[model samples]
Target chain A: MTEERRPFVSARTVAERAGVSRSAVSRTFTDGASVSEETRRKVLEAAGELGYHVNHLARGLRERSNIVCLVVADMTTPIRARLIDVLTRKLQAAGKVTMVINTGTDEQSVASAMRQTLNYRADATVFLSGTPSAKLIETSLANGQQVVLINRDDPLTGCHNLGVDNEMAGREAFFLLRRAGCTRLALVTSTAHTASLIERERVFVAVAEAAGLPVAVMAAGPTTYASGYESARRLFGRSDGPDGVFCVTDLLALGFMDAARHEFGLTLPDQLCLVGFDDIEEGAWESYKLTTFAQPFAEMGDHVVDLLAAPVPVIPGRRIFQPVPIWRKSIRASAL
Target chain B: MTEERRPFVSARTVAERAGVSRSAVSRTFTDGASVSEETRRKVLEAAGELGYHVNHLARGLRERSNIVCLVVADMTTPIRARLIDVLTRKLQAAGKVTMVINTGTDEQSVASAMRQTLNYRADATVFLSGTPSAKLIETSLANGQQVVLINRDDPLTGCHNLGVDNEMAGREAFFLLRRAGCTRLALVTSTAHTASLIERERVFVAVAEAAGLPVAVMAAGPTTYASGYESARRLFGRSDGPDGVFCVTDLLALGFMDAARHEFGLTLPDQLCLVGFDDIEEGAWESYKLTTFAQPFAEMGDHVVDLLAAPVPVIPGRRIFQPVPIWRKSIRASAL
Candidate 1:
């Protein structure tokens, strides 16, 4: 770990090798800095030979580091993985490097992630998952870091909020199932109870009960495919099982569909109808054809980058996006 | 964009507020640095009030950045996403931050990503996808950055190479299909001629042809589900379609299976047999149940971190890992 283990080639070495001034070598590497084309070529060639690279860490200390931190958890999950991909690509195109702080689902991890975001002095910190304390958010704001929260309902000040319209999507799911003549309704969710999941479950249950329908709910485990499969086993083991189901996520829906078809011998849309949230790519496979709501990842990614690239700190406020429904064979066509 | 927009709190502010020397504030934040307990407590409280965050960028300029760059493409793919998830979690546990450079399958993007890795002076760079030129590798090595290439066969010096035994897996897949009494065999791959996919296709075709079995090869599009579905459609459209198919990836196999069952009305094992590479989580879903080879992500992640954490730079060499076969129900039990 000693500094002498690896000797860093400096601009002085490149300048000496190219027979140019140190300022000429620096100008060649710095964007928008003026240097004659002939001198730039010579400097670059020398730098290539000497393995001299402009130190962005030093530059970042003098100015704003074009680094964006994504605080996330369960990054292997379909939806979260897609989110990170879109965000990182979009941010890179906007001249920002993404530093992912994987905060496992725990309060201590969330705090540690926030601390890392501050330690790096990133230009912005995007909370893709896990809720940070208000105190942490305030500290980040005071350190001049722009904060953005995704799919979270917390009303922390001085931070931009972006979320999907889960309530609307959930209500629509209930109406879609009921219109298809489904009498027995059930909701399959997970123990995570994230803000988006809670919102979806609440609206679906409220709408169903308001229409004088009893809705069964199951949250046996975390939001994963296996949990959904277990929930299906428990729910459909009875003679009077639900005819229609609403799953909080596409992964859960796929698992539920598999268990119902293979174990319970129920055919989709004929013996049982299903709808899911988050139109993950898996749901669109020929095997599933799951009818669900699409979270606009591309649009959300663009919006987040725009907020970060703004010249001045834009007024902090919530930006709610509507999730569009994708019609597929998982639900009865009559419901459409 | 102006500096006046957000005022960053400094250690001086905390020191002034706590009536302590500026060095005391620094000592309190620096890990393992000594300060009186009373001064440490007072400094922390004052720092919390003033929101002072130590800048790692400045510290990085003096020594190592503790940043590991992951140059990758197609990060949203199941196996790649899982790889990143495992690598990031392990690296973070070892006190390193991950910087993902998303190099879209293009030469220019790959070159740009390499330049960024050098600019940041990352302690190590792991190439997860898209091969880099030998000239780039040489430059990185000269610049004192440890480099690791995954699933590549390039004989570049001064860089560590890690890859799966794709040849063995492909050979085993052919024998498994043959033992299951599948006379006609096919290999389903993608247009993206990555080293792993090419190796898998090569060994499978060579083994089958050596056994006097003619093999059909179809690489319709990119390595995706849609391409797999299209491959299956074209393969099974003929009257004498292959009964056993070996897909280069699980995603393609799943698509092929769905198309065979739904489009061609073929039953599993009875009418068709399948094997695939990369035992992604989705392959084990109740629907697909794909028999495939596991990439050993956790072990590889651990190895990458261990290489980076070495006090002295370890000698650069190649490390080949064997892919373990996962026997799922996609193949007939008679193959056992």
Candidate 2:
């Protein structure tokens, strides 16, 4: 059918044209509204002719938009920022509104942000930080709000947890390194007592010990480049530097690899073998080619928006995530 | 003066305590409200006692919250993500609400997102893209909104641009490399169109050509690691790999370095010397330790927010930007 184009118009004008009240017109555009589908088509067609671009913020005030609060912990990691970017695009398309709260590591600041997040009456809260405070989680649960954790393990019991299985990830690294004929190995993990790292560490150590291989553990202190630098000093100072190093996170691995190669001229799988978790975009770079546990961020992102859209009861619980390992040239086939 | 610690209270309670209407309490919290100082202080005290967090998004709905639309091109880089994170925190603290609009490489997406960005009745628009369209920039100016481009080039015309000088960065890298004594060199940069990369490429090529030294240009398409991977392959394919290679971005450098060392088994300085721009955290990783340009993301973040928070003018068009360089150990030392 041929359709005629009309001048751009706002929703107010569309409501006027449809002869329906503005609220009725709004209800037509709203998802999950009781408005008959027939009316929705009419409002949409009118909006099409009028060139109306819905003001989402206005919709929230009209109680027509469901707000999703995105709580991001740190921004230094490209993965964190990329996740936020991806979620923003998906949420915008799904017709849901987003409120971003960039919380600090400070407890008081986090607590304050949580309070502000509540005032926004977000339909759901997606916590991107590992180790989201127990106090904050309790408050969120008490308010009967749904909480979803990304790249975070759930210690809050009931919150929906979505992340790669760290235990399996650790084992994958250990087995891969062992097969690569590495005589000595080092585990590079940081000192943030979150489920994500803790589980990975526990599994890595357990598997390495069970195999009866001489393994050393290096606590990177915090997941930062400085920590990796320090770890390198310690590893290099050792009687015999590690032939293989499995970093718990990609950031630390990149750090370890850079310091080892650039500072000390160590080569991977020949002089040393390096592996990391989180197949961040940088890992595939011509320089790093970091062998890592590749979690499907896009898929996880899709799952997150869907999980949070519908409120779920938080039952204090545990969910161990499992992600496949992405193999690169960090280890040589001959060594394996 | 003793302050009473009251339990968390809603706005309604603050209204009751202040002996004013709910709307009055709202107006008091909102910026530029016509409330008396005494009344404003009274409302704030009550709200504080009750542990009330302002629902800025809600206030935004009522056209009370000064909406600041942040148009981010993308946040895939650690430095970019860090800057956006800092901007979000500062803006939130200042009571200026933030609404993000992502404008990636898609020109249509950027233009459409810009229109949606304007529908929010934003008091100002923060263009955070590397290449914000002239049309979008023009539209924002036409709408009489303050525009600030953080970590992006100053627009050719209209809007304030804040970014580091990547050209001087190139000059610095050359000097640093020359001091280290490598005659033949390779300069790898991301897309030649981005203002930052363009500056670096121009200065790098011009300076080397002027100095009568052989210089090869490696154009990495984007700022991601994958792009660097392809560039590194082509660079190494040369009859004799250059003694030193300079990547326009730390991320690209990391990738190029990874492919050279990990995949190709190239030894540092002997086979390939790597230096990159933007001393992102990953550049310091154990594997990369990229000697490169560095910008203070947190400082730039604070700087941009402060600019955005200042009184916006009814008149449009402003230019503001600053740059700094960070040096590391990715390049080779003077050949003895």
Q: What is the TM-score of chain A alone in each candidate?
A: 0.95, 0.81
| Model 1 residue pairs with clashes | A311-B1
**DockQ measured for candidate 2:** 0.28
- How far does residue A186 in candidate 1 sit from its true spot (Å)? 1.0
Q: Estimate the TM-score of every prediction.
A: 0.96, 0.78
lDDT of 1 by residue, A169-259 (tens): 9899999999888999999999986888999999999999999999999998998999999999999987799999999999999999999
Q: Candidate 2's residue-wise lDDT over B1-336, tens digit each? A: 112212224578888987777877888866797888888888888876655666555665544346677777666667667667778888888866566766665677777767766666576777667455776665555545567765556455766666676667778777777777778888887764676677877898788878877788877587777778778788788787777777888778877876787667887765666778767776765555567666766676676666666654422344333345555556656621
Q: Judging by DockQ against the true structure, name the best candidate.
A: 1
Cα error, candidate 2, residue A4 (Å): 39
Where does model 1 exceed 4 Å of error? A1-4, A18-21, A30-45, B1-3, B11-42
The residue-by-residue lDDT of candidate 2 on A141-239, one tens digit each, is: 654556787766655664777767787888988888888888788888888776788788888888998988767889868886667767877898878
Q: Model 2, B149: alpha-carbon shift in Å? A: 2.4
Task: Report, to 2 decimal places, the DockQ of model 1.
Answer: 0.73
